[model samples]
Target chain A: MNDKPLPETLLPLEVDGVSFRHRGQTLLDDVSLRLGHSGKTVIMGPNGAGKSLLMRLCHGLLSPSAGSIRWADGKAASDPDVRGRQAMVFQRPVLLRRSALSNIRYPLALRGMRRQQRTQRALDALRHFGLAELADRPARVLSGGEQQRLALARAWALQPRILFLDEPTSALDPAATKAVEDAVRAFHAKGTRIVMNTHDLGQARRLADDVLFLCRGRVLEHTPAGRFFDTPSTPEAAAFIRGELVW
Target chain B: MVDGNPFAKALELILGLDQVLVGIVTLSLQVSLTAVLTAALLGLPIGAAVALYRFPGRALVVTVLNALMGLPPVVAGLAVYLLLSRAGPLGSWGLLFTPTAMVIAQTMLVFPIIAALSRQVVEDLWEEYREQLQSLGASRLRAIPTLLWDARFSLLTGVLAGFGRASAEVGAVLIVGGNIDGVTRVMTTAIALETSKGNLPLALGLGIVLLFLVAMVNATAFLIGEGAKRRLG
Candidate 1:
């Protein structure tokens, strides 16, 4: 019964040096950084800089080819119970051919939650996303924004402690993007640790409490949002912040 | 004069309620239904496994099932005939010339068709469903149910095709079951036996019943297939 919560959004977790390879080409190369358990951690990198792979590695979807990624709570991220408490929202949300309500209930079903509990939780989540009106609609037929909101609602219903989003707004229009951003900010307000990847600088500025900047599979800087945006210490960070071609 | 006689006699046999003809047609439907069920029991799981799992001999199993799809009805009849004979391993069951023998032969005829077609259905499903299911943290077994539901319409067509194949086949049941006059004769066998015995009216009547059955199964399958395509929302 080690239920003692850590102080100051404790992220006593350790990632000594983690890297990933696909077909002899490196995807993430010896990237190491640290973050607290709460607030938003934005991963910003140019295309092919391995931001998506890094997020997957953090979420335990893809195993790193080298080094270690250990959670400080002494639970392996791959454990079902631990993984159950973590949910990832993909760039292109994959939806089941079911009603919107059922999509929200799916993760609960996996955890073997009670039927009544699942129904109430799903309804609550849908209402939060302003999707209670579309509860019985087929999730596959929803618009891009609606589907993304449903994805968020489903993830929220899981009560995830660590939420990973891989460019959730990249596929959305500006208005739809604003809607999803508001949902992310609301989740962050409730103390969920957010790790998201994005190329939208304005969005990163709006949502990021800290930044993890990467270039060519390596971490160039892991800095506070205010300082990193004002005067980047590293050359790569400076070039990236200035909107210069880093790829 | 003989053409009118044959036509009138066949109509009387059908409209006047011939008991033997009616009994044979009913037995035919019952046996084919049971055979299709048995084929599904044997073939659908095998097809799904071959479609989903990547074991050592999966390719060989699929190849054999595909080759068996064209197995001659007479050859299947001969094989079942030998297996149910007095000297065979299953002879203790005393199944020969009984309705059971006809069912076994017909099941064999339909098994390969169901297996081969269902393999196609399940393979396509795997391509479409595997990643989505896996991402949802669904296990291999649970993922299969989702995949199966997605391709259920295709599996439905496979089953109807199997039933059609089983009901229309003659050589297997005739050779294996011997199509005794009262006990084992079905629509196809009774039609064959009556035709050879110059009972043109009875044979023609059974033929009409068969033509009606084949048309019905095909029409139902096509309708369901089209409906599935239209209702994908």
Candidate 2:
């Protein structure tokens, strides 16, 4: 589903010795992994495994207590230009108190896009996501699934080089979950690197090209999607895949 | 100039558009509106700045502001009176008994309310939108307008609160203004003077008008807020 080639400058995200601590508690303890040039990478682990915290640290929403996160072979991840080329969707959608269309338009507006251009881009995005009819409604009032769709649509409108999702569909029912998965697949097809985290192993199996299996704030396994599922490396990963409590 | 039931006399003056009443109303509006505008101009940015950034002494500033929200008008008036009074530091300007002095007093009294309230509104919105806005590539400065616009309805209520404070205040305006007839006398000050003179009707008249003005300001703020909510939603 390649729509356009990704910019060469965006590839090969690198995390090295990154650790995050808050109030003397280590949330992510000296974890490091390299995400190669392309494809959808899913992070899976039991609850409290720091999956969400890791994504936020990578997304630059939170600074790591130690070490660094880099993209494109040592390009600082937190640089505004780099961050501008990226987007992150939280578990619960964070929408502006604006119209559905305005929510889509806001990021574009922030980039100094002209009003007319922002309007048209937002409209195109809404239509692309099949949210055109809900365009004028306040984004906050949308049903949970709809708000998630709108959030994804807003990210889509930015044409980000990297899209980060933290449990994007965790709160959705089956149908809604499927819809979000479809959107994620479409983004991957469009050549935006997808880094996501989910506890749903079924979803991980369906969408991951590479698996980053974290447990208890440490990386227990990073392997190809098929191999990670077929020949589980760690006892923790195996226990997790079998739906046993592994923490 | 006339005697009888003060309420009826007040009505007659109001209905007859007494020049004195008209002048008083005009000056009251001029003074209070100016104060509100000045305070908002000074307060909103201060509030937004305080809410959006972490600086040294921020907690102390916020605490002081919260405390100052209830500053007595008399103290504010007394302070301005001191500042602008003859033989005082600012006495050379001779602003002590003028409408400007009342505006200055009201501004000092109400600035904290507008700033403190806007700080709260912006702070709440900042919590909600901070991550979202930052992810959108907005710097703290860039995010202020967005947070302020999104919280405009609540901010407008803050403005109305400041307006109410400025308009209804008597002690500060009275002490600083000297309640000069046809000069610095506003509705509140006029009411005080007229009541003390046993001119109950005129005092009652001014009181009614003041209440009406306050009600109108509050009603307008509510309607605008509701209109925005409905239209946006």
Candidate 3:
């Protein structure tokens, strides 16, 4: 797999009639949406709206109880080659007890890469996030913002084709939030597909090419950024953007 | 008319026949050490596997091992005794009343404890660390071992505990070892036999030594546990 033509493979994603429920109450109900390549798709929804569940389903973490999710390149959700080309950052990053460089090198080692190549890749990743100074520090000891940055650095160092983030910066302080936003924009500049969920409308406007507005286990609309904010197609989405307690 | 205090007289007996007492304790040490090493080798990987994978029969294996964790020591001894008896399959080895038989019974007694605790430690790690590694493209097998390394401290403490339990228990060794002097007799059995024969001083001395041994094992375990906490913290 050559890195030719600068991001040539932009496989779209398809969700076909995916449905999930718990104890008779639906969490995601027959949801269908298409994710195009080379753009940020921000998932915006109110609390208890199942936005995170949708992200997990997309990233192949949760197996949907009904229907099927397929990639645009006709790969099934369980395919390792396809899944390996994607990465995710949770709301709170999980760092290993080892050093920062070791954390970055973990996935590479899992792929059976040789020791010297693994170390080089890890060093390159550390330098990218300005974590080179702390390469030997135990990853669990980094500050909240630094950990999230390191998590992003590790994910992106693999050059994954798609990155799914579940409110990655929702827990950070304002200063840290800016750092994470800067990282996200850098990845965006690299033409990596970004699918993210956030409650902050300001963040959505800054990051999204299109908005996937969700409410109560349903997709309210798939509207462009400008129209989604100014003239939401649904009453629920408009209320959510305005912080009017859609729930 | 026997004695004013059995423990007091037992101490005298232990001091008088110091060689016998020493021999018993030495044999106990050898057998228990061997059993624990064997248990760790056999048990840790199986425990880790059950904790990290979700295949068919996984739950059943965990449940059975958990049930075996409380297996009575004498019952384990009896089970092993039967297997190694003349009429049983393993009788050809002539191991029915030997130190080897005692080791096997003790292994049976504490193998479950090591395995069960190891499973608990590995499972806790799997629950917490699986998602992060999976997101990083770690295969299930690789991710599980990494999780085990994260919980290395707990696994170490588990082994120490297994050692203590195996070395200190009497019921299993008493049944399978036959308590033959200079051949199968161990510290626990000698302590019991000397007491029954109204040997108070030797029994008291051995009892004190046994207590000291337990204290040392626990002290070592505590220090190692603290060291692990510092490294991982």
Q: Considering every candidate listed, which one attains the maximal lDDT? A: 2
Error of 1 at A217 (Å): 2.8
- Tens-place lDDT digits, model 2, residues A54-92: 998888888898988998857787776688788998888
lDDT per residue as tens, model 3, A18-122: 898878888999999999877899999889888999998988888888878888667877788777788898999888878889988888777667888888888
Ranked by TM-score, the better of candidates 1 and 2 is 2
TM-score of chain A of each: 0.94, 0.96, 0.95
**Displacement of the residue A34 alpha carbon in candidate 2, Å:** 0.9
Q: Residues B75-108, candidate 1, lDDT per residue (tens digit)?
A: 9999998899888888898997888888999899
Q: lDDT per residue, candidate 2, B18-93, as tens digits?
A: 7888999899999999999999989988999899999999999999999998899999988998899898999999
Task: Output DockQ, candidate 2.
Answer: 0.63
Q: Who is ahead in TM-score, 1 or 3? A: 3
Off by over 4 Å in 2: A1-6, B1-14, B86-95
Lowest summed lDDT across 10 adjacent residues in model 3 chain A is found at A1-10
Ranking by TM-score: 2, 3, 1
Best prediction by DockQ: 2
Worst 10 residues of 1 chain A by lDDT: A1-10
Stretches of candidate 1 off by over 4 Å are: A1-13, A233-246, B1-21, B112-132, B194-208, B218-232
